[model samples]
Target: MDNNRLPQETLERVTEETDNLMANYNKYVEQLKESYTNAQKERKEFLSSGIEFTKLIESEETEEKILTVYESYKKLLDDRTSLSKNFLSEINSLLSLVDQQLLLLESSYEPKFGIQTQNPRIFKTNKNNPKRLRNPEDADGPQMNGKYCICNGPAYGDMIACDAFHIEIPWFHMECMGLFSAPRGNWLCPNCRPSE
Candidate 1:
């Protein structure tokens, strides 16, 4: 065999080995590409499914729905609270006005009518004679004579004289004369009434 020329069988074996290596590398590359394509398809499917699931969760009634409902009703709740507070304030103002009026009435007038006694069975009557006529010789003047009344004699406090009856003895205490209501028109005591 010549030194510069390779043997035919050895060349053929080397060429066949190189061809086999290239075929095996091409097969590995094809498998890697197929695997990459499959991974991409799986990723797409996962992403699409995730989006659909998120949409379904959002559409369902959950915390978001509750939040929306709370937002809508918050104004009504605040309005009701304000109205109740205003109503209570008005009622309190009216109560204060009524209390002030009551205080004024108590300070302005003193109660004088409806005298209560301990004994319910005892009837009130004068101890001395009420209709006794003063002697003309003993009489001092008309003013001194008219100072006393038939009922509750001897007018000590405020007194009023009746113009209708008892022209002789007309002065009487307003409370003792049973003039509870305001003194209007001519008033006459019970002792001076004309006998029916």
Candidate 2:
């Protein structure tokens, strides 16, 4: 009887799905670049308007004209700030969606791998020197967020890592992770907990 366990077709689908995912990632990257360009343009506009506002404030002009210029300058600044915040929120949402996708991809193969396979070479490495770090650029990126927390909410306070596993991605919030005390040594999240 087929019990919805990892089907043979699941493995086959992984290859195709990965290709599709790559294409989507490339498209999203282009969108990210456009957002960056727009941000730079907005920054320039803000700078120019700020200079104009400064000049207006310094000029020995009528009070009405000064107040009008100040009002317009404030509005422009607020609009730019709001747009920037919205753009950042969209980027964060995209990041969270990608994380969810990765988790789905991993779950699709868990039945076959038995969730205990020690040979998951998720990190690429040099064959000659096995001890060397697999991803040198990982350290340069932003710290991992609690996107995968069991609570499914934004992480609050300081985040911590598990020593039992390499923190390729953080899985919990400091307090929300349910750990009573800070781990002294190796610790594992529920997903990675060894079945004894």
Candidate 3:
């Protein structure tokens, strides 16, 4: 397997799953809003009917009307409870899925961001050499005196000098090139590597 592909794959999967989770969350929110609206409407209707029943206390139909209203209210309460339970269950399940996805992302986080998880190799460079003078006329932009590497960074830490004789900025940070230690043999920078 290619070293680069794993992080890319994990990133794609996480993005897809996040999109799905957002869609599901939006759907759940809409359902909750509709349920709340319906519940409020039912409660208002129930309250108005109760008030009307007070005026009908002297009529013979009062008992039967009150019984009907009571049953309807009870059914509304049961429906609301059921809806709440289902919503909570779904939210819990979604949360669990999110947690799992987070764990997966954490595992691949370093590689995905090109961060080195292992400790960098500590090595010493020769300190006796004098800094080189920059040539303004150089084709690769104004060369910085004493600065080396593709990053144009100052010489410090673990660095490998390219063996290519004609190369400019021969010194390269091993970390910049994802190297743990200096190569056992002559090393070539990307630009100087011969075409395969």
What would the TM-score be for candidate 1 when compared with the true structure? Answer: 0.25
Candidate 1 wrong stretches, greater than 4 Å: 1-65, 110-196
Residue 81 CA displacement from its true place in model 2, Å: 0.3
Q: List clash counts for every candidate, in order.
A: 0, 0, 0
Model 2 reaches what TM-score against the true structure? 0.33
The sequence of per-residue lDDT tens digits that candidate 3 reaches over residues 1-196 is 4546755776677677667767766776776677677667767766777787786655656656666666766776677677667767766776676666556545543321112222222233433436433443441222334567778776555666677899766667788888986566677888899899
The candidate 2 region of ten consecutive residues with least summed lDDT is: 112-121
Order of candidate numbers by lDDT, starting with the best: 3, 2, 1
lDDT of 2 by residue, 98-124 (tens): 555456555544422112122231211
By lDDT, the better pick of 1 and 2 is 2
Q: Which ten residues in a row have the lowest lDDT in candidate 3?
A: 112-121
- In model 1, what are the clashing residue pairs, if there are any? none
Task: Kindly indicate the candidate among 1 and 3 with the higher TM-score.
Answer: 3
Model 2 residue runs over 4 Å out of place are 1-61, 111-196
Which is the leading candidate under TM-score? 3
